[model samples]
Target: MDIHYRNEPPQFDGANLQMHFIAEVDGEPLDCAITAEALEDHFGAQSALEGPLREAFQRGQTLIRAVCTRAIEQGAGPVVLHSGRFRSPDVPDVLH
Candidate 1:
């Protein structure tokens, strides 16, 4: 199983960042929120990531990976975030 997402530009909030995103698994909508703080816990010091959107999208990818990991750990079967031509399932590669 794989998941794909389309994320909006992140909304910054003090020490946190939130990305509004939409995802689909088996082609069904799965609305989710990707936050920088959460990513920091999982990834650490995202503020050092250089650009704003770049960091935001990176957090989005971390969110996707976390979800997949949780599913797999629960014996939910193999899952991955489909990749195509360097495309990001959670957020756009370029800054918006």
Candidate 2:
């Protein structure tokens, strides 16, 4: 699958309390999000506020995109990456 990520900034989805981003799979855009909890747990996000969350997302974008790409390849419709997903041994510690 040709998975390409958009360069757009992640948007805070207050309704779902997650940061949303876009990835194109073979020219089709897929909805993807990372939970605030995940940011806090793995990316050193001190709070759910946009600034901290965005900083955390920037630090962890590589792994986050990898995880999202894996999920999409596995046939997930809309990828929502949570804190627990990052706990896998194969997932790298990409905090900066």
Candidate 3:
């Protein structure tokens, strides 16, 4: 499956405490999100506030996309990236 990420800006979902972004898998749009906890733990986010979370999302977007791709390839739907996902040994330390 081919994954193409959109150039759209991520939006902060205060209710969910996550940042939502869009992607396309084989031309079909897919919803994806990364939790605030993941951003704080791995992306150098100082706080869960909008500004910091957005900055962190931008800074770590490439790695985030890669993770999303892996998840999609594994048959995940509407990817929801959490802190626990990054705690696995397979994920790189550079994100920490």
**Could you say which candidate leads in TM-score?**
3
Q: What is the alpha-carbon RMSD of candidate 1 to the true structure?
A: 9.7
| Cα lDDT of model 3 by residue, 1-96, tens digit | 889999999989999999999989999999999999999998899999999999999999998998888889999999999988887777766755
What's the CA error at residue 7 for candidate 1, in Å?
A: 7.4
Listed per model in order, the count of residue pairs whose N, CA or C atoms clash below 3 Å is 0, 0, 0
lDDT of 2 by residue, 1-96 (tens): 999999999999878879999999999998899999999999899999989999999998988999888888889968999998888766665633
Instruction: Assess every candidate by TM-score.
Output: 0.39, 0.92, 0.94
Candidate 1 stretches greater than 4 Å from native: 7-17, 45-56, 59-63, 66-96
Candidate no. 2 TM-score: 0.92
For all candidates in order, the CA lDDT equals: 0.45, 0.90, 0.92
Tell me the deviation in Å of residue 72 in model 2.
Answer: 1.0
Error of 1 at 90 (Å): 21
Ranking by lDDT: 3, 2, 1
Residue 63 in model 1: lDDT:
46
